[model samples]
Target: MKFFTCSVIMSVFLQVCSQNPLRYWTLLPNILVVEVNGSLGQQPLSCLGSPQEGTRKDDKSQGIIWRKNGVVEEQRGNSYLVQLEESLGGGNYTCHREDGSLVNHTVVLIQEDQTERRKILVKTDQEDYLTCLAQNYNGEFHCSWTWNRNRVGKVALIQVGRISNDSDAQCSVDVSTQRWTCSSGQSNFSCSVDEHGHRISCRDEQHCPYAEEIQQIYVTLYVRTEQFLVENYSKQFYLAEIVKPDMVRISEVNTSMIEWSYPSSWSSPYSYFPLTFQISQFRRGCKGCDNPCTESKPAKTLMVHFTDVCQFKVKHKAKAVCVRAKDALCNSQWSEWSHLRLRRNNKNKHRQNDKQG
Candidate 1:
């Protein structure tokens, strides 16, 4: 019975040790040498148990107690040591356990030193529109105009002649209209910087030329007003009387047929005037010559004769003119003298044989 009781007690003790593994614990830096005399002890003890298990009633608690330099620096675990020296002044320090459930030791924490603020510079091309931007490591900065009144805001500046603005950062000047306003013939323009302020100046109306040529070519005349006044505004004036083609004349070669054409400015689809030619031999400078040709009406082209009685003789000259009339008044221009030279009999016979062959 006695042996069975000792065996049962040993079995229960082994089971408890195996189940509550927190009984074995380790602490870092087992020895702390201090410069002052103090008393130390551990309190508010806790456990570092396995993650798979919750707090068990059989879990063992371990701690430490020591003294140094009249101050208490309590630590926990086995093989602990504390030494006292004279260098460290009197102060209160506390060191907590890894789990923060207990105070293990104490040391004073001093404040760290600081560094100076950083500075940066920005630059760009002077010819371009003024634009400013800044960025830093912390991604926060401020931008403002340091020179010109036109660019007084955070944005860029644009100034052309008298027009100035901050929203649109580019300046443009219309030099063509500037010349017309100054009544100048020739104009030169240039773009420059106003560095006294930060404005971009576009200069115009400098070194202008004469006035007569500028006034004559620069006038804007509308063709629509002339058409409106001729058609809609005036009822008494008709277009047929004002828009007639001048220099009308006529000519004839023989009695059988007549050929005619005109040199009027009346273009296609606007006017189509035909001619009628009458031929007569009134006066002559020599043989086979017809002179002093007159027309009863204005004809369009020259007259051609196809009759046998009016066969063209050798070395004969015929004159004709194209004529067009309006309101019984005719305008005429004469054509070049049409020399009526007949072909030889042998040439005509050869042409007939070539056609037949």
Candidate 2:
């Protein structure tokens, strides 16, 4: 019985000594082996002391081994090699020591390639309300549409569809309420906008006439803000010599020199005004001189000579007169003729001279 008691004490002591204090753990190929030293006895330690089911803690004093199932290698060292079963998504991971102290770790999994989402469908058209096309859209993410350039029409807020997730955007003219609607089918779209103040009419996918054509129709407006008073001036008219020498005697010269004079009152203080004159000569009771002579000139005062000489016999009536002159600003009426009645007899000339006096 004494011997049995000694053996029992010895076994207890050996078990206590085999429980090592300095233990090192690491990962190796296909196995997790921990090494314990500095103890009184050398014995194999069971790694499954307490089942490390989940994440491991980082405590040097604790005798627990915890790791994920993917950790295929473990050994007695500072670090261990962990073989992952599959790629890990971006998330947080922890490494635990035997003492239950944990080290937080982050893991990122890289994909082979990246791909963008494609749009299902894209469309555009005109709108009646506001000015542009009423937009309808459907999608999961946010979408937008815009005119590529500034347009003649007014722009409004983008309209998003409730049922389909469709969004619409457009710009339109103010007067006619015409618009061009552009949308990104999935990613991008393009459209043109006019900056000029003109009406744009889109027909069958074509832009209407430009702003220049519209400006040609409407005259530019000019406004003056200054104030001033103007005085009213009365206009006056006077007889002016439109045709010089209104009367011409066919017998006075081979071609008569006709001259005229105007009233001083007819002169204007502003500038010279242009006038046109017409002269006419008439004769009666002469067979060869029955045809009248007439001439016209554009001048303020004109001197006209008659090439047709009078062939009337004495005692025949011949009349030469000054016709009227007309212009944009003024008009002068005809003057009375100085009638001459000739006689074939020299005695009749003396009588006519005496009668004229």
Candidate 3:
């Protein structure tokens, strides 16, 4: 009789898979993520029990109790069938023994509707849902995302590690600090979510500025909506690629001399992570003087400064002076131009005109 029951269960499982085809992943320890196509109708979720219970998910128990999103529900056997409609059909399903001891839990997520359905989060202007940046190479970075107008959600999980060696990475969270930590052989990272749930900040404690980085960091954030719909957004980058130096402070020592320093957030020893500076001085009546001009503007400048001590000398006073910096050692992005508008005094103006005459 038991053999006959196993055969019937196998037949039904294969039949379900054949229709919609299922893909699942173990998001955390016993937390499973099941992806299904909403248009495909119903899908079956098997109770993958704990390691000690049995190896196969189809193993028999002393009867099972089912619950949907923490509330008990009537579900027979070891499998619970869920419809494949959008949020209406999605939920967190768990099965326990008749004694109420837990077995396993699965969170069902519907894929972007192939025909007419939409995803939980919309793409941003940059064409991606996630964006990350680093102020320096101190093994720290922050990633942010835009929430969909109607389907706001929270981060369900975060995974970060070096490329090709992240399979064993483990992540845990601290309730008190609301911070998360992911540790692996190569590095240890701590991350925290912002109050608005739109941004996450992370830091690597063991990062070395001098060490050669042959590997890249890969990060994935799993976000879920109130309806139990989850989506994962991932990004891979090297520290140098996303390194954006802070604005340089340009101070006027004298009319002819302008002095500036490295951004305080930059990595130290200035020589090791040197920066290249560009100084531009705009003349009066220039049409583009209203905004910060890029290097393409009609400006005369040279990449001269490569240390913490940055200074530029002006032969004549002009409308404004702008300064920007970029990583001298790497082909990275330049910082925003720091502009200082110059106002010529009438006395100095008369003196200059007399000298010119």
Candidate 4:
């Protein structure tokens, strides 16, 4: 019975593939996918509707017509040019010969500019684990994101560019490994999705630290699952702006004081990539507490010099303590707070009181 079900499923899959029109067209070698973009008057859409290559022996005798949104716009031309504002320029553009046979069809999507799609990069608490990080101005960076719980998806496409419209870029995937590779005029890189297809990691080849302010990395990821669901997520950022340091670890050095050190993964020689420490005291029971960092009236904020182990006396009689850190220079984002439990030693307290007496 199982074998029969498997065979029936395979037959249905092949039948669906045969019914798809683009399936066979995409297999043809040397097929051209023409793309164009334009603004109001600065850029106009002048596109050729015929194949650039291959001989058209009857072209001289046949007349061509171009139409935008099913309305005839041009009567004769090998290439059609639109000299209108971009807002009035987008439509289903088609080309035909005098014989009333369709020669080509192209979809013109008009936009103010390419960066319009970059507004989706805002961070939110619901975001699972989507993050893009780079330590230096070097051309190498990594982007990783996770999906909502119980939702599974695989990366079907990856696009990267400085502008939004330059998305003609392509990425090749390794099915066995789920890794992706893409290259552009100014960037070259590869990425890999995890086994569950919820996480991605990328490396940039042409990244450079020069002109950091003017440079930005724009990324778009298309994900699809077995249920035929598709989604696109996009983000844009500069390397330095998103460089988040890992959480600092705090440990008790003595009864009177606690010490903390930088995360092991942070940039080397601590002198350069220093981090500031923010210590917040929390009692066993607190009402309407703000975030651990801001819970106290005035957080005990201290600047820890690079390359130094930070030590601060725990003067508060609070039951618990929380410590977090952030980059000293940019102060971009804070790391996760580390919690410590205080074990009050009454013997030591008595000894200090006796000495005072």
Candidate 5:
């Protein structure tokens, strides 16, 4: 039912957007976005001569003019102090030289009402719009989200820290590097958005794998739509809970025996952080030949520890083997199956893989 409503809103928006492209130009990368709480009484915006320069802002005093949505505004000199008692300030403000040359521009977005959960991105098959995963306990993770069919959005701000109430935590993006950094007392994290703009990879430099996690990591993503609307989504978790091992790399050792190994992306000191492998094998004439792995009974199932054993003996009638792995210490997601078909002839002809039961 929610999806149906989104489709209806999308159709209506498409018709309105087609008629005016420049009016919705806030989606462009050139303009900066400022999020404001409309409930606040007043706000001040400065029209700096070198606005893009971080350290030097609001330095322009002479020969400066301000305009809101391309309309000239005579609100004091180089700066406009607007009242935000009821709504988001002037839609988009651009600073121009006295001769009308463009200097810098910004769009002000009123933060969405948290209770209503305004729609900027519709949920995918998942219950939520965001999906995050970590390959190992290396203090690194990546989060991704799918875009809506009718809306184009970009990451306007990212806030990450150990506590959700970290009032001093601030984030800033470097467009040239495509990287952003968040500074907080508990943890300082840096993230880089991918070129495609669909995903963000972040790292916590202070992570210690040897110690237990006492606090949760909190992450919030602020996305702005083309129509100057903004919405925020957040998540919190401990890295261990989100760790997912990569697929196991299985290879045929010989016709009578097969072996498997850990994924390359897994952390070192295999014994300290071991993996538990599950192997399922089936006979050539198994009951479910069409989907052998799922239907066939595993000839042999072994839960071998890395330090103890990594190989398994194949059964005489076994035709194929499927293997997967998970963190031995923690109950986590399983890796994808590594499969291989065995040959009755010499091992060189083609070796069977994974030690089944």
Candidate 6:
């Protein structure tokens, strides 16, 4: 009995450590991943400015070079300081030696922070409800929201209850481990917040679907800022209706052949968790066309089974292609499309053949 208890405790400890945010933060490379709000500001990213890994003292004397999206970047320092103009601060930045050898590479994926201004205008009210989404049909869902303008806060507590007047249950959070656990009736809930306090993700430990009219899960969130202002938000949802698969990533693009894989975050076992796919093709239009949206046409629709990769043979004239997937058997919602531009390689192949001869 004592041995069994020890083994169980060790398993729990390992699970908690695996989900620890501090560990994740440390693992992140010197890449400064930021969301740009069209503001000129300095991001104190020492990681980008720091001398390249394995860079010797002699190499530093030779000076370092920086490039943005393959174009040479101005300004010399351990860090790359620039105005966050949409055209300027976004894209892949690489530091190289004066000899043109690669040193370090940092990719800055800048998403538009559209909520910056609206957040300042809108005030947090008691009537405000959190928005939730289930990326896949089974297991979990994520909830995120912007706090009242000018208020920085942390999630103080989380509560769960059934929509059917069941007793309210509480979730305990381990700040160091960054895990939340709760037990409400027969369902067990686990949740985690991101490095930023805006998003929260929860999983149902006992989620099993049975034929029924409808079912709902209720979640409550309590947030507290440094000023001690406590505000709570609640939301109720049915997983089936809200299940939206994430955009499938296009992995391989070849002549008339496009291949993709399921999102890694999806629930396991492709045979059991089947997903239907949708493909769209965008052909080249008249030069200087005003709108390309009117030129898109449905390409193909298929299902992913037995294998993780989905391949489609499209027409040779196709210029661009897109693919998306959703729950195959269930009446769940479809996923946003994953897009790719096809660069025909017939000329390059013929050139290679001539060179070989």
Ranking 1 against 5 by TM-score, winner: 5
Between candidates 4 and 6, name the one with more favorable TM-score: 4
73-132 per-residue lDDT for model 4 (tens digits):
844555555433423344556777777777766554332333333232233465623577
Q: What's the lDDT for all of these models?
A: 0.27, 0.28, 0.75, 0.57, 0.71, 0.62
**Which model is ahead, 2 or 6, in terms of TM-score?**
6
Candidate 4's TM-score reads 0.54
Off by over 4 Å in 6: 1-128, 175-178, 209-214, 251-254, 285-309, 345-357
Better of 3 and 5 by TM-score: 3
Model 5: weakest 10-residue lDDT segment is 19-28
Better of 5 and 6 by lDDT: 5
Summarize candidate 5's per-residue lDDT along 143-248 as a digit string, tens digits. 8888776766888777777875557567777856479898877788999889887788999888887788888887888787766667778888888777888887
lDDT of 5: 0.71
Q: What is candidate 1's lDDT per residue for 47-71, written digit by digit as tens?
A: 2333122134223324333333334
lDDT of 1 at 301: 32
lDDT of 1: 0.27
RMSD of each: 41.6, 39.5, 6.1, 16.0, 11.0, 23.1
Q: Give Cα distance to truth, residue 317, candidate 5, Å.
A: 1.6
Candidate that would win on TM-score: 3
What TM-score does each of the candidates earn? 0.16, 0.16, 0.77, 0.54, 0.71, 0.52
- Locate the minimum summed-lDDT window of 10 residues in model 4: 20-29
RMSD of model 4, in Å?
A: 16.0
Sort by lDDT, best first.
3, 5, 6, 4, 2, 1
Q: What is the lDDT of candidate 4?
A: 0.57
- What is the per-residue lDDT of model 2 for residues 193-253, given as tens digits with 9 covering 90 to 100? 2343221222112212211111101011111111100011111111121212223232332
Superposed Cα deviation of residue 312, candidate 6 (Å): 1.9
Please list all clashing residue pairs in model 3, or write none if there are none.
none
Candidate 1: segments with Cα more than 4 A from true spot: 1-236, 248-258, 270-357
